[model samples]
Structure formats: C-alpha cells, structure tokens
Target: MSRGTTAVIDFDNLRHNFNVLKQLAPSKLVLVVKADAYGHGLKQVVQALDNVDCFAVATIEEALTVRKYRPKTKILLLEGFLDKYELKIAFEQHFDSVIHQQEQIQMFEDFQTNQVMNVWLKYDSGMNRLGFSGDEYSRAIKTLENNNKVNELILMSHFASANQKHNKFNTQQVEKFIKFKTSHEISISNSSALLNHINIADEWCRVGLALFGVSPIEDKTAHDYKLKPVMTLKTNVIALKQIKAGETIGYGQAYTAKTNMQIAIIGIGYGDGYPWSLGNNATVKLNNQQARIVGRVSMDMMAIDISDIEIVDNITIGDSVLIWGINANGNLPLETVASNAKTIPYVLLCQITSRVHYQYVE
Candidate 1:
C-alpha cells in the first residue's frame, strides 16, 4: 500500500466557517485564498464557495488561479502588480489591486488603459510593511483619485497585533487608519481583527485562516469560535517494534527509552510538510490516543512512542494516524500543534508539501 500521509479537506466545514465569519462581520467578505487557500487546494476552494464578495491573493499568478475558477468574482492583488506587464494583466483580468507604494501609483499614472481598475490604498499604520506612510499616503490618494484609470478606491491597513486582543498596537492601528478614512469604503479587519471583534471594517473584511476553520489568535482554538477544521492531516503506521530501556531512537539518537516500550514508525515527516521543529515535542493520535514523537522527524517518516496507549497492542501496519484535524476519536486543533511547535497555524497549513496526498470531501 502507498504511504497514507494525506490531507483530507472537508468542503462542508469550509462553507460552514465562511458562513460563521460572514455572520460575525458587519460588512461584506474578501475571502483571502492566497497560498493555495492555505494549502487546502485553491482551485477547489474557490469553486466550492458561493457569494464570495471578493477573493484576495498575494501574487498575480495566484490571482489568475482564482480567476480561472471564479470567472466573475472580484479578485484583489494584495501586493498589487510588480511591473507594467503584471499591471496590464491585472487590467485584462479585471483584478483589483492594492496600491501601497509610490511606484505602483506611478504605474497607474503612466499606463494608458481605458479599462477602469478598482484599487485598495493600503496605509502603513504600524506594521511598517508594504504600505504608504504619512504624506505618502495622502499623496497616493490624491494621485489615484485624479487618475482616470482608477475606479472604486477603498482605504485599507493591516493589524500588526490583532491576534493579541489586549495589544495596544491594535488600537493605535485603528486610530491611525481612522484618521485617513473618508467617504470611501474600507478594509482593515483581517481574520484576527474580525474574530476578536477589534475594529471591524465598514465595507470589506479580508479573512483567510479563519475561513479554513483555524484560529489566527493565540490562546484560542477554532472550536472556541464555533469553527470546524477543514483540513485533517493523516498518516499510517508502517512498522512497530519494542525498544529496550536506554536505547536511543531515530537519527542522532535524539530520544532514549527510559523503559522497555513500544514504538511505531509512521509514514510522514518534514518532507511531507510536518514541521521538523516539532521533533521530540509533538504528539500524534493513534487509536484515539496521543503518541509522543520519539526522535528527530526524518524526510519521509518519524517514530512515535505508543507504549502508553491503551490500544498499543492493537495498532498494526497500515493503521491510521492523525497528524492533526478531526477524526473518529476527537479533533486535534492545529492551534495546539502550532503552540507545541513554537509556530502558528498559517505556517503549518501553508507548509504542507505536495508529497502528501489530498482528499476532498463534501
């Protein structure tokens, strides 16, 4: 049998999360489908959802990918175009663009297209990332407002600490964003901002991770917000053996057995996008019981300590193992895994490699 490392995508849960997010937000939704819908398969996700106000992506090619599935749905280029060639494609594809830099605005002033383009003017409130700041922000607004090619203009900014509900930076970002807000519609609430009830946007809220049924906030799980996980990563036991006390396990002999214990080799590892940083610290679900990882995660496999499991003796080759997400016994939140790995849910999802198989369920 083939190695059973797989990412099972539940479209029903995806739609459910979308509805939950839509009900929570005051304005329409700009579903962020960048990074292959957070590695849950972008094309399938775009086609599955209906009534999406807009689909936002990081790059021009990703925007085009969404466009291929959603012919008429609005697609926003989060980083906007890099050069005139991409700008031309944006216009041709009717993709909305985020104008955050002086050069992007200059491109608009120089391009000779009769086709009008919608633009999101991103202000660098505090993130100090891609955005216009201070006088540059006002100058860009004036330039875009005068440019004939520019159509609907929306004011936007990003929250640097929306995930931390008590972070004062969130308040500062809102205040900075509000100072420049005009009669135009605005988009400032990312998944964290919307979920945490921070400053909800007036016209649109760009949500990405939350829609995939994973929480963006620390100290919280998606279940805490009534969100169901859409991606359940699973693998299979390929071998089982008993290790004597003091015997080290796997590469570099990272882990030593304190007593005679059972171990199982699962067909998944960093090569399949499971974080290597999780080595010797993370756990996987086997027979509905948590099995501690025993060593450094290898390229195609890892060892799990199954000696303490109640059903340890029952586990056999080809038995299913849950890396994360819902299963028969219970759900393992990606948030929990993220915390253990010293990372975040977004990285875990997006880092999933193509080596793992994908199974979509309605």
Candidate 2:
C-alpha cells in the first residue's frame, strides 16, 4: 500500500511446492534457506517453512539466524565452518554440519569422545569447487566412520548443469554420486534434480529454488510444472511524462521515442535487484498490459515506454508496476529476468538488496 517498492512472498505457493515435493519424494526435505531463501526474506521464509524437515545454510551464522525463529528445526551448514568453535556451536545449538574438508573432519574428531555427529561428507565428484579429491574422500569418510564421529553420512555434490534440458552432465554427476553411495548414505538432489532427476532422489534430496518454485532454466520455466513462485517483486510508477517522437530519454540517450509516447518511471530498479543492463529490453506490467524500458536503468528508478498501455493517459502517481512477479494471471519468472541479465536465478534472487521492505503473504 506504500508508494515505494516492496517484495511480497507467497507462503501459500511455497507450501504448494513443498507439498509437490513431498508427493514426489518421500525422502527428507532440507529447505535450502541459504542466501535468505534466495532473497525472499530469511526470517519470514523460515517461519513459513516451519513444517519442513530441516533447513540448510552455507554458514553457521545463517543457521544461527534461523535458529532464533525455529529453534527446534534441523539445520545443515552446507560446506562451511573451519574449526572446533563452529562445530561446538553446531553441537551446542544442535545443528547438523556438512564436514566439507579434512580440517572440518579433524574438528569433528576433536569432539569424537563425547559426540556422534550427523555429517554429510562432501565428495569432489568433479565439481572440484569444494569437497575432497581422490582417496581423500574415502579417507575422510573412513575417519568419520571409524571414530563414531559420524552418526549418519549423506554424500553430497553440486550439479554444474542440472537445469539444462539436454545436459549429459547430470547423468555423469549421478554416476559419480552412485560411486560415493556404495560406501556411505547419500543426499544428492538439488532443485533441478529433484524435479527432473527422480533416479537420484533416494537417500535425502536437498532442494532450494524449486521449494520457492523458481527455476534455474530459461527456455522452460517453473510455471510449466505444478510449482508456483513464492516471491513477487513489485514496485510502483512514481513519475510519468508524455513526449513527442525524437525525444531521447534516460542515460547516454540510449532510447529515443519513435513516436509520441508515455513514459513511466517505476520506483524499482538496479539497486532494488533490477539489473541495470536490462534498461532497454526488460518488460514490466501495468494495467494488465506490457511496457518496455526506454532508457538506462538508474540505481533507484527505471522508465518504461508505456505508449501502448491504454486508459492511463497521465501516470497515476501510485499506479502499481511489476519488477519480476505476478500481474493478473501472468507472472514473470525470476529465471527470465536473470537470463536477460546474463546471470542465473540464484544470483538474481540473492542479490535483492536489503533496502526494500518485505511482507509474508499467506
């Protein structure tokens, strides 16, 4: 109801996605709230997902943040925490930690005498970003297994291209995960795999974006499935101008009106998670009609060429506009916006700045 832009999160949609996942896989669900539920608001998302089996975070600090809201929820620190202090916090706070490196194993080994930990062993498995390589994985698992430091072991790997429709890479990753599974229990499926790779869903699947119904792929959107988006990034038109043909607008004079047109500057822009580079091509919605940007997207505002939108001659000061979300029955997938930005859904979702206000919609 305010004049400025704000992001709206639909818990109903999140619950729907969670239910769809539950029906698809009986395996435990780790609601990936890492990166503030992909910038859908951290504390609010956790509160809405209180029914989830557990939540996963990249760092202990994130886990601790969620702990305040859901004190009893099972939490997994993805591939972080360097030493005993982090582990001690995990132990004391009762969070399941992913033992990513050998040093983390040593930290777990420190508490071996008194604590049996639920640990997911990170196997490099070709991601090569984190986890152990070669025999180091076997040695890490064996070390944890032998010492009783490991109460349960889940093998985890990050897929490089699980979202691609024709990627052979997923199959390759699955085979590698299967190899790790022979020696330990496994948890392999991220969002894309949970939807398309049912073959690997056993053992427990960790889902992040899909739980919020945002896809990683562009050509095929999450809306194609039973999934619906949980976040609606919205804004309002703050200024409007009528100009004749040959009138240039915005920075660098990137756009000049081909004919007399109406331009509306919305309150949301790059600083509010709208990508600046998309000034000329990105689409926004108003009065159920599409509008296109006419100039460079400034840090705090963007102008849309609304020449075709009818019934709105003068820009109503408080008229609503969409950044990347629903307008009527149509919705702009976060995937589409990210694609336009030459990035991915994960980065776009996480980069939503803290300036905008957030409200949870049930």
Candidate 3:
C-alpha cells in the first residue's frame, strides 16, 4: 500500500525559477543545493539542474554527491572543509572552498600540495556569522594569492538584511565588499539580495530559496516574482466521521465541536514534516473548499473540520488533499504556511522528512 503522502517535485518549475536568475546577465547563478536541495532531494535536483552555472553545497559529502551527477560543473563547498582530510579531498576533486576564518586560511596553507584549490575569501561585512574580519581579509587574500596551490580566488560575503529592502546595511555591505576586493571576482548576494534590485552581486549570486520557487523577502511572494513552486505536498483522507456537539477531539482535547459536524482525518502530521504548531490554525483543501484544522496535530495524522463542507463526489474517502504548495488553481504558498507556523519557509521546506514519497513531475 502507498504511504498516502507524497511530495511532488516539478522540474519545469525549477527550471523556470533558474531562468529568472539567468535574466540577470553577468551575475553567474550559483544554484545553492545545500541541505539536500532544501529537502527537495539532492540527486534529483542536481540532475534537473545539470545546465546550471554552478552548484553550492554545505559540506564535502554534498559536493561529492553533486559531482557524481555533474562531473564538470563547478561545485562550491560553502562551509568549506571541517578537517584536513576533507580539505585534501576538496583540492583533489576541484571543488571551490570558501575560507571564512584565519584558521581555515592556515589549514589551506598547511594542506597545500601539488593539487590546486579554487578559493573564495569570505569577507565579514557585518553578518558576523562567518568570514574573516575586515581587518584580516586583505592579509588572508595576500597570503592565498602568494600561495602556488591557490588557482583562483574570489571575494564573497553574506547579507544580514537583504530581505528588508530598505535596510541601509544592505548597501553598506555591498559597498564594503566592493571596496574590500583586490581584482578578484566577487559574490555578495543570496535569493533575497538578487530580487532587491539594489545591485548586490554582479559577478555571482548564490540562490537557494528562489531557485526552489520561494520568496526570500517577507513582503513579497514567489508568485510576485513570477516563480513557480517546485514542491507540492499532498495526502489523502483516511477516514471521515460525524460527532455531536461538545465532544472533544485529538490529544489534549484542544478542540470541541459546538454542534454536530463532519470531520475528515488526513494522513499527514509532524511526522511527515508538517508543523505541529499549526494545529487549529492550519487550513486544508477538501471538495475544492478550504477546511480548518480542528485539533492538535499528531505524529501521523491530522483532523480537519469539514463540518460545513457539503458532502459531494469531490469529498470522500481516498480523496486527495493538498497539504501545501500549488494545488488546483489555488496555491498554499510556503511563505504563508511559514507565517502560520511562526517560522520561516526555509525551515518548513527543509524540514520535510524522508518518510514522504517523492514524485517528480517533469
């Protein structure tokens, strides 16, 4: 029997989003496929993005996985190597490594051998999460440029407030990155920065959420940017029933029916990567109408208040229901779901578990 839940990946939509970035000429799009393509499945995403300019992953393992599919495409290790062995593997496999700290620079120098390593010196332009301090960045660059094993060097920094649009820090960081560079190529934008129209990065842009058809900016949406969702999470109604007024439902007895009403139990919950915090506030589609979740979400199921939904051919057992993503003519945008869950789309999208079956829609 099927699991009754699945995540449908649309390759065409993925390509459409990538092409959106392609329109910004000269800024090479570094497709960020880290965290298993944001939990959309890594190998499949890599295969679909075969023609992309480059791929960025968070670890050496992810880089190798992408390399297996696209042997010649540029693969960047965003977190760089954690140890000497990984650093050696990066050099031998021709993967670009981002050197974010003085210790990382020291490691690169120590591990220098016959193999050449493509390097990107990370500049800490106020994010303070990673990268060398502004004071040490120049010294780090000079050291790498003098090293014979360093084949190419690029300057890159992360934005702390690109999504804010009006934040002065975005301009400040961009200008700081531009001034910090010493004739090397630069990359200083993510998905949000690319859409802000503030001219963040002209040489390269590392996009993750945007490529997956999600808006990184809070005030906008994927549709607003003409990007289509790539993942549609869906499930089927496992059972239905009617209950009298004042009867409680689910664990914690959080919900009570005010009157006789119909309910539909869906085969989806936090176990399937649905946010449990969405209980009583989440909406699901049934019979082409919206239904509200009635109780706390369980490990493997959730109950929706379909009491007012008129019973029809469209509403029945085995009927498919959209948990999130695009369905019918309506879209359950991840951004909206994230807001309802008191989280960000990045967490919700990446938190999708492996128990759910994935079907690719090309």
Candidate 4:
C-alpha cells in the first residue's frame, strides 16, 4: 500500500502502435526513442520495438543504450557525433549519424576511420535549428559523398509546423528539401506529417510521440489514428474533506471556495512529474467522472474539487484515480491534461520522473 503513483505500461499497445504507423504509410520507421523513450523507460521500449527498421536517439549515450538492447539493429544518433572520439565509436558500433553542421563535416574530415559509416544529411529546410544552409548543404553532401569513410547518405529534414494541417510552411519546407534530392534515401515525416499529411513521400519516417499513443496533430486525437495509449499514470485518493464557502485551499490561498464543497487529496505532485501549473486547470478520473484540481499543487499532494460530481459518495478514500490514460468510460487523455497545462503532450510525457513505479505488461 505505497502511496506512491505507478506508471502502467502496455507493451502490446506499443507494438500495435508500431504496426499502425507502418500501415499508415508503407515506409521504414525509425522509432525515435529519445528522452528514455519519452520517459516510458528506454530499455523496456527498445526491447519491445527491436524489430523496427531502426531507432533514433538524441545522443551517442542514448544510442549506446539502444545498442545494448538492440545489438544489431540500426541506431541513429540524431544529434550526431559529439567529438572525434564518439565518431570512431559510432562507426565501431555501427551507429548511423546525422550531419547537420559544417563543423560536424570538418570533424568528419579530420577523422580517418576505415569503418564506413551511414550518414543522414540534415537540411535546415525552414526550422533554422539544425542542418546545413544553401551552399553549405552542397559542400557537406559532396564532402560526405567523396569521403571514403562515409558508406550511405540519407536526406532528411524536420517540419516546423507539420501538425497544422494545410500549413504553407509544410509545403515550402517539402519543396525546399526536394531540391536536395541526390538519389539517396529520404526521411521528412514525423508523427504529425504521417497522420495529417500522408501525401509527402519518404523512405523513412522518424516517429516518437505517435509511437507512445499520443497524437501530434492539433485537430485530431490518437483515437482518430487507431493508436492505443501505452502509458497510464495512476494514483489513489488518500483523504477527503468538506470545506465551507470562502475558505481557501493549498499554499498562497490560491483557490477560494465559492460554496460548501468536498475535496479529495491525491498523493502526487510536480516532483512526480505532475506540472504544478496544472493545479486550477487539470482534470483527473475517479469512478469515470472528471474531477477538477483546485488550489496549488504541492510537492506531495493536490486537492481536487469533487463537489460537482454525482458519485462523490461512491468515491471513498483509497479508491483509484487516473491521472492520465485512455479509458472507455471517461479516462482523461494526456492531450487534455497537456492542453489545460498550456504545454504540448511531448513535454508532459517526457517529464515523467523516475520516482513513479513502472509496471510493464506483455
């Protein structure tokens, strides 16, 4: 009877999501398992999705973690090499790298390795974050093409606004990327583009959030794409109390009750990856009814207003409360919680801390 919360992981649902993405577009998928598989536990997720075309991670360390679980599977270092030493290790381990900067190209030029490495040439397109610019793109590509240490070249770009359907920037970026075609493999679509913009062509799709059963499109949901939620964050109501009108709740007296009401204190907080900003706006599920959190979210507990619900009597102390998950009888989706928190689902999912228990299901 630990008051600590638990994160239930459904491996079957994760596999189902992989298949769903593969069916959505007949292309190879590089499941982006960065941020410890979006905080779903990296080793467990990699063990589950080892059959994917490849895996994408943000660091050489993340790539190494995936390599431990998936020894022979192709692992891409999305951030590419950090130094000359890592470049040699990446090749020794057969890890693919993304070349996005001229400095990286210089690093590649400086290194002399007999092991030919696969490289994904990143084009800035319009994100202006990573990847090479106009003439630099040609120089980098030409340099890699001529370098004997480079084995294969793949063209890639990240969409700045693919989630917004009919975004002109999507077309502009795609058009820009198409100009760099060098008969190499191409990958551009993320979860949003794969679900919303299916017309875009690519040999590979780098999917991260969608594989975790979260939708990237603004107008649609995971249900719209036949994806299943893989992670369910659950906790229990430890106590309940009645409050009179004009009384305040939590620190700073943030919430003043307008009327006499009942509140339930759940054992979860920002320390457990629950956003403190979600105090007044977040919703949780109890007996299939939504309960709004009131006042500020403390480090160990938060108060929820259960006065408006019909089954308050039935929701006793020690009863289960769903922080976020998919349920047929009104489970609170992560998207809803994220929307209320004024953030994207990715941030919320990745923010899940290690303090929470992880229960993996086959």
Best by lDDT: 1
Please identify model 2 stretches exceeding 4 Å from their true place: 111-113
User: Residues 265-324, candidate 3, lDDT per residue (tens digit)?
Assistant: 999999989999999998987666788999999999999988777664357788888887
lDDT: worst 10-residue window of model 1: 194-203
Question: Which of the numbered candidates is closest to the native, going by highest TM-score?
Answer: 1
TM-score to native of every candidate shown: 0.98, 0.94, 0.97, 0.96
Off by over 4 Å in 1: none
Off by over 4 Å in 4: 327-329
What does each candidate score in C-alpha RMSD?
1.0, 1.9, 1.4, 1.5
lDDT by residue (tens digit), candidate 2, 211-246: 888875567677877888888888888888888899
Q: What is the per-residue lDDT of model 4 for residues 1-362, given as tens digits with 9 covering 90 to 100? A: 56748888999999999999998865799899999999899999999875678999999889889899899999999989979889988989999999898888889889877788999999999999999878888888888899988899999999999898788999999998889886898999999898885567799999999999989876556888899889889888899999999999999999999999999999899989899999887789877888899999998889999998886888778877889985433567788888888889999888887788899988
User: How do all the candidates rank in terms of lDDT, highest first?
Assistant: 1, 4, 3, 2
Model 4, residue 324: displacement in angstroms? 0.8
Angstrom error of the Cα, residue 236, model 4: value is: 0.8
lDDT of all the models against the reference? Answer: 0.92, 0.79, 0.86, 0.88
Which residue pairs collide in model 1, if any?
Answer: none
